[model samples]
Target: MGKGGEDYGKSEKVGFEFRDKIFPAWAKDVKECEENFQVSHEVGLSTSEVQKRLGIHGYNELEKHEGVSTLKLILDQFSDTLVRILLAAAIVSFVLAWLDGQEGGEMEITAFVEPLVIFLILIVNAIVGIWQESNAEKALEALKEIQSEHATVLRDGRKVRNLPAKELVPGDIVELRVGDKVPADMRVLSLVSSTLRVEQGSLTGESEAVSKTVRAVPEDTDIQGKKCMVFAGTTVVNGSCVCLVTQTGMKTEIGMVHSQIHEASQNEEDTPLKKKLNQFGELLTMIIGVVCALVWIINVKYFLTWEYVDGWPENFKFSFEKCTYYFEIAVALAVAAIPEGLPAVITTCLALGTRKMAQKNAIVRKLPSVETLGCTTVICSDKTGTLTTNQMAVSKLVAMGLRPGTLRSFNVEGTTYNPFDGKIEDWPVGQMDSNLQMIGKIAAVCNDAEVEKSENHYVASGMPTEAALKVLVEKMGFPGGVNSQSSSDHESILRIFPHPWISFYFSCIFFYKP
Candidate 1:
């Protein structure tokens, strides 16, 4: 159904190119998508069909262009204009020293010493730059390792198999559930529950989870407004849904953004500090060249004038040997004026600053960024996760049966998602209060969230809001916590119904367990 022939491999031979084609499934309804892709939403594609599609469309994975090559990175360190100028100066000094030796004259030790020191400085600078960039690249690779590795897909029209996310191809039906990270960009086809909510904070920077439905949205709707599409890299917060794979790898929304980021980073310009330093180096080189030229000219002119005088001193004759000596002195002065230790000092300072930042949990990718920090005056930042903790916690709770003007509210105290550390106070009511007990039971039983210990603290595996409500119920010293015997035995949660059309209410049904 994807291409022309039933065999996906043969379809490619028949010249069916689907790579460049765009499938705007977000704009189309489920029925239309089924017709367009020639797939049945119920049973999904058969094994043969899936294999064929896989052959036509490659695996779904973001292209991680290999980290900058070690050799290339090391070479790049010498590419700076300042570094190149220093290298040129070193080469000239070495050549002059060699010429002196060739002329049967004892080579001045200083001539060789200056070039050797310059060469050593260049080598150290290259090594430090290479080491920093290599570490930064490795850190990026580690981050990629944290992405979803496996996904659930419907195959052979009946079996749901867990396969590597990278093996997913277009038109495949992917099943998503709570705590599952979406492996690829997909269009919502059918929902197993009343609604599905996804935490798209990674993609949209939204603190709240977004509700998704099978209803097709207008074509003009932005990515954040799309109700029927679930993109790659987002996590499912609640409910379960079957989605049709529409795009993969660089074709997906998040992948496109990653590509843009890579492109921008590759074309990143020099920082202000680096630019100023480069300008300074160039200006200094010019001034040093002028000074060295003047020294040689003045020495040669004085020697030539004295050589023409009838009784000129023998030691002051402007001969080839004397000319060589004058040139060597000028060369040594030029080398001295040029600060060979400046680059090494700057590199060391940047390295020290980077280490300090690492201790504070900040990674500096480039050395110049360390200097940029000193010149920074203001920092504009996002408030959601940066200024505040990106976790939901219950702040206050009120009993619905409380009389008007009664001080019946309880204050809830906690930070982050850990429920064990919460404290509830200012409650005049006892635990046996019927209304308070009912609300606690409702909050606990009518939710689908779970909490588990992760390393040092407890972490939620579902919606943070639901986890907060469950935590609140626990803080009240409810018997057996959220999963208490009384609630589990009497009340069974049917389904969570998301009401995005309304402002702040989500409905859930609870049935009496016989």
Candidate 2:
């Protein structure tokens, strides 16, 4: 149905034309959306059509901007204003030394030592900066590999399992189960369970899982309120659903965010330490230039001769030997005034700071960024995963006994979702007393989370609180755990609503017998 309870038909534009249009998928009904994409509810796109769309839309993976080349990284090390000034000074010193040797009619090896030492210091600093930056980039790339690698797609009226996520294209049908990462941004078509929910905290920063539906919503609905759609990079937490892929690659919302972040990092400004060093270098160069000019003037006035020569156009003739001596002295003075070791010392200090941060599990991409972090006094961050562990497990349980005012407290053993690691402490010392047995049954029947063994470890696929409750039920040996039981058994015993979708402060499970 359309907005305001009106009937809606297929879009004016069909197929790939509507794919790149500024259209919102959540505003259209499932049938109309399928029609626009030229797909069917039962059978998905054919092999030929899937390949064609893949060529047009590209892969579902995010675009990786090209990294800095080795030559460019080395050149960038000398791009600092201070380093440029020092380079000019070193060239002048080398030329003066060469001229002095030419006047003496023999090459002097010791005169060229100053320039070589300055060049050596600068090279060492550049090497340290390049090594630290490359290591940090590798660490960041490893962290970005948390997305799903494979997905289940529907093609040619049959299910294709374990298909790589990068091969998915627009109009493809994808089946998502609990604990599965969403492969692409897709519109919900239908669900096989009573309720379907997704954990979008990585995308939306919401701690609660969002309930999904197949019904169309208003066009002006915000991203968080779009119940008819699921985005890429999110995870399915509760039930299974089949969705139609609408966007892939850089067209998806998460891809857009990655593009923005990449652009920001490329255009990052210089750190405070770099700015201060540039200003200091400029000021020092000005001072050295003034001093060199003064020395030359004093030498010209007192030491050089002003004898007249016949071949010269001008009347005065200066002593060539005395002039060359003063020029050499001026170059030496300027080179001495500038500290060639300062740049290397600064680079070494920043490198040391980066190493300390790495030891503490904090990666530093740039050397100057270490100082930037040291200047930080307050940090505002999302509390869900940054400040606390995102996983939840039961720690303690309290139940009321059959007597009027009797209460018993039992401590759950482990802090993880694994059920076999620890045992409950301070039990009632019987074959599961009446009160504890009822509590265990209620915990198992009411929870919607599924905790099962994948390989060697157990993983959970629902709300953390509910997952903790399911683990508790398993430890108490409830019938068939949670996921092993049939849906018919749950429907018969759980007549009233047991799980609360919105609030979780309290839960009620009703058991009925006819």
Clashing pairs in 2: none
After superposing candidate 2 on the true structure, give the runs of residues whose Cα lies further than 4 Å from its correct spot: 1-20, 91-117, 139-146, 301-303, 308-325, 352-365, 370-381, 386-389, 393-462, 466-498, 502-514
Q: Pick the lDDT winner.
A: 2
Pull out the clashing pairs in model 1: none
lDDT of 2 by residue, 441-489 (tens): 6677666577888777787877788888888877776555554444325
Q: What is the TM-score (0 to 1) of candidate 2?
A: 0.73
Q: Which digits, one per residue and each the tens of the lDDT, describe model 1 over residues 300-413?
A: 864464433467555444577777788888888877777788888989999999889877656677898899988899997655545655578889886664576565667788
RMSD of 2: 7.2
How far off is model 1, as Cα RMSD? 7.2
Model 1: lDDT to the true structure = 0.76
| CA deviation > 4 Å runs, candidate 1 | 1-21, 85-124, 142-147, 301-328, 352-364, 370-389, 393-447, 450-460, 468-514
lDDT for model 2, please: 0.77
Q: Per-prediction count of colliding residue pairs?
A: 0, 0
